[model samples]
Target: MKRFCKVRWIALLLLIVAGTAFLSFKNSDNRSFQLAKNIDIFSSIVKELDLLYVDTIDANKTIREGIDAMLYSLDPYTAYYPEDDQSELEQMLKNTYGGIGSIITWNTKLKRSMIGEPYEGMPAAKAGLKAGDILMAIDGQDLEGKNNQEISEMLRGQAGTSFKLTVQRPGVEKPLEFELVRRAIELPIIPYYTKLENNVGYINLSTFSGKPAREFKQAFLDLKKQGITSLVIDLRNNGGGLLDEAVDIANYFLPRGKTLVTTRGKIEQINMSYKTLREPIDLDIPLAVLVNSSTASASEILAGSLQDLDRAVIVGTRTYGKGLVQTTRSLPYGGQMKITTSKYYIPSGRCVQAIDYKHRNADGSVGRIPDSLTTVFHTAAGREVRDGGGVTPDIQVEQEKLPNILFYLVNDNLIFDYATQYCLKHETIADAQHFELTDADYADFKEMVRKADFKYDQQTEKILKSLKEMAEFEGYLKDASGEFEALEKKLQHNLDHDLDYFAKDIRNMISIEILKRYYYQKGSIIQQLKDDPDLKEALKVLGDTEKYHSLLSPKATADPAVAEK
Candidate 1:
């Protein structure tokens, strides 16, 4: 019976394929004939390779490789997803996944996996797991020698599954046992929202997913009740998600029936305009959106739409320009492909697609739209905007780069180690917003980092090395030897001096790391705003009613970049 069923299945597949070829042949169009011919050739080549190849071939893998190669000719966003990766993709966009709901990090020096952070109300947090807890083992397997990926795999499973964890929290006498039942954890699209001074509300929309507009509505309404007349929707580093969600979020500020975006494609059926479907939450609220280079796609749609409609003042750096739309099509055997199907245009009739991927240079390198090619578009209030790239900011705020010395300490886990030590000694710390590293605390931190065996090669040393190589190549090494030796001596970085020189920035970093130990992500969020220059500029703009209204009106003077990060 099994053999008969297999034969029947094969027969059905062959009949369907034959019918498709017959239809293509009957039509006799060049495209259909070419497609049919290529498919036949592909089938023949695969059959021959499987039967006559020198080495053993995995048929499924070979076919997948062919599919990937075929898709590689398209844009980067068009991708093939195998059967196994389907679930992961679904979980990422939908925000529903069965896992331990905690993030872990592997310390190469310590050789232990430690909890970096945990989602609130998740299995890991509910099981009494804290930020600094060390995972000794899972089930019967020891986790000490395992990397983050291996340990993470052990913690994930289908919902309703049980797992045993051995966690060693700092200051605890012994390892604590936890029996946790994994469940579907749904993370919020808007992770952080707070009220700032002068009655400004800050809402961070990390991604357009899982009813983000609804979430933003609630957050806005709640803040309105708290007397907030101004809002800052931070889309910095938001890579974006669903397009409809972007429309919905834009609708929160736009009036009903206002055209939000229009998508055009090869197919007339897909070419359509999306508009605000409901009454706006508050049209008169002073709105500013914070965007960075990573803010893209649907995030761009929301930001660009709002900007084109003159609903929100765009702040921060220019956004990530991605105006193309993608649609995922299911393939056979549970596989899928995400194909770029359309380009989205905002209210100003501008497609902010920066890269011209379809057109390549002589050397096959993709080209970006040149400055001369950028077209100008006008907003609803007649404010000048440009196309062929991202949404330009009305005001730009530059972020400070971490000094190399501070960067080295942070990257080498020295800061993490010191924060762990500080938490061990101190029972508690002040609120995140109020927390500040004192002079004596920095002194202690300097000492701790000194002993942490941190080292960094200076940029000047690299240039010196290059100079020495050039001198040697030119046979002038002996003449410059003495000068090179003196320069090397002069360039030798003194740890104590460097630490003192970059004290404020280093201290802020240490303060944040320390906050993470006590308050987790909640603390980090609050503490980040304490020194946020962008937030300061946003508040300044919103607080100054004259500047705010002028920015929205036609022929208004745009603020030059106050500071480049």
Candidate 2:
């Protein structure tokens, strides 16, 4: 009787699956048969693998691998989130977490976990854990040779709980222990803002999460109180977040009922238009929107809308092209699926989605839409704009690529180590915008780098490697050995000479890292603004009101947007 009941249930499942396939294929018998055949084949394969093949198959891992391969054939944005990742997903939307608020790094040379910098007023800061403190143990558990991720997991916990850790300070011989009670760390969304020269306000909105528009409103009001006539909204590395906040920010410079964006999908419910519902805070204020390659999604929406209406002058590189919108659906257990639901279009009727995921290449790889496929669209002021990609700035400022050594120094924490040493000696320094390391200070830093045993590959080394590989592939490596060896010897980088050769670049980086210990993110921003090209360009344009208005106004005397080469 049990066997008969099991057979009946199996039959019911197959009937339901066949019905689903029939409906999906629009009643096409051949397609429906093909779908059933594939399902059967797949099920048989899985069953055979689970029962007969391998010593012991990990069912969950195997199933997830299959699911990942299927999803890989789709767009990058469409993804499946397991239950373990739900917290991270929630934190992205809410921007709050329970942890000992501190940035950490793994010191490869020392083979120990180290504290990078503690967020001001948080657990780590309150515990007197300074930057460069080596985390030797947490909760009496040895942290020697532990990676940053392991140390971070050890540190993070629920609010109101406590974690014990021992850190080795630079001057102190003995390890200092501290028992820090955890709390919900709410990181500042608006990290830095300042009233610049000529009363031009600057607001660097790093993320769009948890009522950022409200924070922006407060920043705007503060700037207005300071008698600022113009504003620069910097969105250089903002990878974007909540769409509602983006719409709210757009509403600040636009009137009620003005359309901001629209989303369209296969379903009717997904088709919706988002318009500004509130009156503008300041409709007449001269504004400049700054963006770069990392600016995307909600950021693109905000920048694109302003440009479409000719409300603000955009200054920076081309933005990250991302127009597809995602929505989450509850999966079985506690897992959730974040799937691409629709594609959003800005006010100019241009979809800034660059990649073509649906129509894959012959090799099943996705390719970005070619420039030839991009169509021209007219803005509200009759200015020409392009669809099928991201927003292009009115005044483009190309970022310079620093030397590979500079990157290695920063990435490998050589600069960080020197900054920590500098901090121990000096309690304070000059203001962020006006601070520069002296020649003596730079000399000490170079000595520190030498002691740290840092080795970095130069771009010339990469070229040499490629040359050697080509010579070997062409069967001439034996004959070319002498020349290759000579080339390698000639290209050898000296740590001593590199310090002075890239002195200016190294100085700027070391200054920023050192200032962070004193003033946090605000310090970094303040220091950067002193030599920021985008800010300079914005200031120049704002100073000349005629040029600023000409960029926005339909009847222009001269075009401010430099044509793309």
Candidate 3:
């Protein structure tokens, strides 16, 4: 039956190609032939399938699937926004969506869905759904068979609509049911802020959404009331949003009329300069900006401006070199195209564009600027800065890469599943600020691992197994079968060691997941801070005034030493 279906599809495809070729050559100036021919061909195929195909076809859904498949070949960022999804697309760009307001990931091992951080004040939080809750079912339908997109569509709806979910709590056998009314989940530009120490304030800015300048001003005002004298603005993994918001944020921290950035393009009319207004916030406050490779666009703008003016020390890995600016234009349908308009340059006369996208290799892959191609520009204090891709942090901090075993553990949700089990067994844990995983708990987790079906693929296993099979087939194994068997046992033992030997790393994962159930998103972050290398470095820089300023100064290019870690 499937073979027959494929044959029909192939026949239809050939017809479409032949028809397209005829229209292309037969009518050079016939817009009607171009549009009408394709439309007519598509209509005929659909009609034939509806009348002759054995299975019933949903015309609307089939058309949508076809359109989606066509667009999927392009980059993920470019998509077809169907009429039904037009409003959802707008909300995504505007940084708001209507749903339960929790990030969820499927745990295939657990045979359920694990909840991530819930946006504060949203339906999920209001209904008492905590992070680490394994979602078993939605509206009485088992979620085991549904994909992420399918579940997402089910969870989202118009505001004020209600949905019911059954969740298996970490420490409980019975699934808990909750009824939640959906609402618009609005993500603030600043989601988290607090005083790190007696005098230093920490603020995590995730996006440059509209009115972010006002939001930052308000956040600072509130922090000022708490006696914040120094500030740590974290922009790690911030992909950026509105360009105007970036300018406004820079204006808040910079001196008036200072050139923050400028944009240039092929068209002279589109080129413009962005500067800070005369009215400024407290410039005396010591500031430290944290960024990583994921920080681009507006995040880069803020970091670049601060570094250029000597206002703040930039720390962490190089920023994502996205200097291109985009503007949205409505298409004929409800769809819109967000096309690149220009490339933005920071104050040092250097465009923080790392990749030379206009120039491609023979294989059409974009190339990053070579060290020799990078141009140097001066900061406000004559500090030399370079432009090519992303903004290079003044103080470079090395990020630790996760070990392969830990990577699989996290990605496979074994860590999350065990954490859920731990939560189910314990009703109450100590306050997140003081809670620590005990040796006894670790023992129980080890036993849990023995019962799990967790599997990992390693190169040694592949090579050893392949060699053993080859030897046996070629009659060479008769001479050394015993040795081969011994080696196989040792390989399996090593595989076992990767799971048990990395107990401390595994424990950290379980601990964080458990902590989040009671303390929420902020709780996990606070608890993890004791061992966070980046946070420790931020604290050290904020504690020392001379070190902070020197790091921002371009002349201070000495490699920062790694202490212990």
Choose the strongest candidate by TM-score.
Answer: 2
Q: For residues 1-565, write the lDDT of model 3, one tens digit per residue.
A: 9999999999999999999999886776587678888989988999999999899999978987886665544323445665567655666577777789988888775656667667667789888887777777888999887777778888888888887899887666798999989887777577667887758888888787656777788888899999988888889888888877887887777778888878887788779888876577787888888999999988999999888888888878899888887666677666665556688988877888787766667776666788688987888888888888698887788887665677777777777767777776777989877899998987877676667766667668899989988998999999998899898887774646775777777778778878877676666766666577777787888899788877666564555565434
Task: Write candidate 1's Cα lDDT for 24-143 as tens digits.
Answer: 877778788799999999999999999999998999899988887777666778888888766556764686778878888766577788887787678888887877788898887877
At residue 55, what lDDT does model 2 achieve?
81
**Compared with the true structure, what per-residue lDDT tens digits does model 2 show for residues 41-144?**
98898899989985889988998888877777787766777886565667677877778889887776688888887888888888888888999988898987
Q: What is the C-alpha RMSD, rounded to one decimal, of candidate 3?
A: 12.6
Count backbone overlaps in model 2. Answer: 0
Question: Candidate 3 overall Cα lDDT vs. reference?
Answer: 0.79
What is the descending TM-score order? Answer: 2, 1, 3
Model 3 misses residue 551 by how many Å?
Answer: 2.9
Candidate 2 segments exceeding 4 Å error: 1-47, 144-146, 362-364, 464-492, 554-565
Stretches of candidate 1 above 4 Å error? 1-28, 37-66, 69-73, 143-146, 168-174, 361-367, 471-485, 556-565
In Å, residue 441's CA in model 1 sits off its true spot by 3.0
Q: lDDT of each structure?
A: 0.84, 0.88, 0.79
The stretch of ten residues in a row with the least summed lDDT in candidate 2 is 556-565
Clashing pairs in 3: 170-424, 171-424, 353-388, 353-389, 354-388, 354-389
